[model samples]
Target: MARKPGLLMAQLLNRFIWFDAALQKSLDIRGHGGVRRLESMCMVYVHAGIRRPSELARLLGVTRQSVNTALRELEAKGLVYLEPDPEDARCKLVHFAPEGAVMREEALDIVMALEAALEENLGRKAVDDLARLVSADWGEAPVIGKKGVGKAKERKKKSA
Candidate 1:
């Protein structure tokens, strides 16, 4: 059965939540303790070089305060630390601690295992094609104006 495009994102989110649950279970067994979705997301963004809290909030569609709170919890877990941004001392940047890096590597291994399991059920080509399609640049998201007109928003630079 063909799926509706509008529901695709929701389906993707559901899949991600399933992955998150599996990840948390594995981490817990490995003594990483309970890691919230937001904290794990923060780690992924920071690992990808998005360090500023404001930027993380924007990407996550949450408030800066929320991002800060999650960061604080992560710090308490000894997974990450907030350091002064050299470019702007007034702002703090997120960086993974030594232990955090190790943890991330372990999580990545888990992800690989999950992907392998998916392949076992869905075939290797299907999994590879899904990854390629999602990773491809699909251009900008649409901006809907009043009267139901829609237009693509220009791509913005990832500057901090």
Candidate 2:
């Protein structure tokens, strides 16, 4: 018997969803003050120096509107603030407020602890390998009407 083409991807996605849910619950219990998962992710990107709303949306693979909504929530919670970008008059940059900086540190510490737990569960070597695999460049994305579709048609013809 053969495994499905998307089996690995499906499994990884399912695990990530469950892991994110657990992480959210853990953060809530640790007094993170009811932040949503998207808000937390946006903060991480801001901490990583992605300041522009458009850039954050691109990095998170979400729409700019969604990022803006998350930013608004974070701002309401006193976790983030938006300031006019000096270089670009039309855009605003996202920044951590004083409280948000502290929250960012706590979030990072929690993430590190989770990584350590993963290492313990999967072994250091396996965890390292998985990290390497995930971080490696997989080349450009495939386009539906381009080479990918043509290749699929060719494969189908060959099989038929």
lDDT of 1 by residue, 1-160 (tens): 7998799989999988988888899988997767899998888788789999999999899999999999999999889999999999899998888867778888989988999999998999999999999889977666664534342222222331
Q: Top lDDT: which candidate number? A: 1
114-133: candidate 2 lDDT, tens digit per residue: 88998999899998998999
Residue 154 alpha-carbon offset, candidate 2, angstroms? 14
Task: Score candidate 1 by lDDT.
Answer: 0.87
Off by over 4 Å in 2: 1-4, 146-160
lDDT to native, each model: 0.87, 0.84
Clashes of each: 0, 0
User: Model 2 — TM-score against the truth?
Assistant: 0.82
| TM-scores of the models, in the order given | 0.85, 0.82
